[model samples]
Target: MLDSETKATETPEDHADELRLWLRLLTCTTLIEGEVRGRLRERFDVTLPRFDLMAQLDKAPDGMTLSDVSKRMMVSNGNVTGLVERLVESGHLDRRTSETDRRVQVIRLTKLGRAEFRRMASEHETWIADLFADLTPKDVRELMRLLAKTKASAQKSAARRRP
Candidate 1:
């Protein structure tokens, strides 16, 4: 009795389970991310993007090029530039032209920035631990195993879709 459009819009019973699982995963991710964002803003007065940038720099003691940071953060150079400007202005980061390549700008966290990041990271770990407190060790391990498989499957699908 349904029209073509109506039938197309409807999910058959076979696909319902996959759709529900996807929704549940998305919901959990959103909830956790929201809580982390709020906690970071309230406790550190810092945004997630800035925290992520600093975390990347923390791993690279020597510093990283603007392009490299942009790639690692999976954002545009402009975004990284703005964050770099603010952090430099706040004395939390140091930026300089690469001696070998004048056109390249390398950035690294300053002593102040490193200290602040370490402090924030320590607290952030605790917050994450608290968030997963309900999960038992076995549950955590199982989730990790399943998520790894999921990630591989997703990556394969993405590669197939790419030109």
Candidate 2:
């Protein structure tokens, strides 16, 4: 009774559950990410990339090379260099030459940076919790399990795609 073009434009109800599930996941992730980005900008005057860089340093107290940071963050070296320079000027991070490799530069968060990052991280967690407040504990657990499976599958697919 319906033309092909009209059928294609129909709602997810007309399609497979997988299509609906993927759309829901994408929408939820986008909504949450946008909220977090806005909050960070409004409250901290910081960008997501800077926050993520600080988070990486938080995990490694000693410090990591500029190259290491680039690899871990999956960003370009130039990008990491710029962030490191800005944070250093702001007194939130410190950069030093590696003792063993003079050519290598290591970066680490300063005391101020660590404290600030902790505050940001705490608030970020609260925001996420609030966003999912409607979900029951059981629902949360099940969602996490399913997401883990999905992530593993995606990772395998990515690996296969790599040369």
Candidate 3:
């Protein structure tokens, strides 16, 4: 729930270095996501969910089914349906039944949607770069490497938790 300007500033004295590292990673993620959400809303009048759905479609020009989007976005199908409806109404996307399967609703970004996403994506990159401007190239590379390791560890732990 922390905003971009806020972070996990309170830490117990007894916490281990791993705990501190996790908190730092979480704080950075929250800050960046919050900022990106705000910027997308302010500049494009769009919510992060809608923007993210569009991003998925942007990557797959062939389009995706409603359920496919739901899986990819880790959201409910109903959630994606509403966003798809709004985007379609705004003429930013097009939806049609799949040729082979009439039950499947395939969604894709229109030309206008592509252009709009490009604009937002360009600003998004600049915002991220600015946020990390304090980090030197070496620092960035080291962080990237470390984060990759952390990600693998987390994924392994998560897999172990699954039934």
Each prediction's total of clashing residue pairs, residues at least 3 apart in sequence or on different chains, is 0, 0, 0
Q: What is the Cα-based TM-score of model 3?
A: 0.79
lDDT of each: 0.93, 0.92, 0.89
lDDT against true structure, model 2? 0.92
Residues 44-150, model 2: lDDT tens digits: 98998889999999999999999999999999999998999989999999999999989999989999999999999999999989999999999999999999999
Tens-digit lDDT track of model 1 for 48-158: 888999999999999999999999998998989899999999999999999999999999999999999999999999999999999999999999999999889988999
Best by lDDT: 1
State which candidate, 1 or 2, has the greater TM-score: 1
Off by over 4 Å in 3: 1-15
lDDT of 3 by residue, 17-109 (tens): 878888887998999999989998989889998889888999999999999999999899898889999999999999999889889999999
Which parts of model 1 are misplaced by more than 4 Å?
1-13
TM-score of each: 0.84, 0.79, 0.79
**Ranking according to TM-score, highest score first:** 1, 3, 2
Number of clashes in model 2?
A: 0
After superposing candidate 2, which stretches have Cα over 4 Å from the reference? 1-20
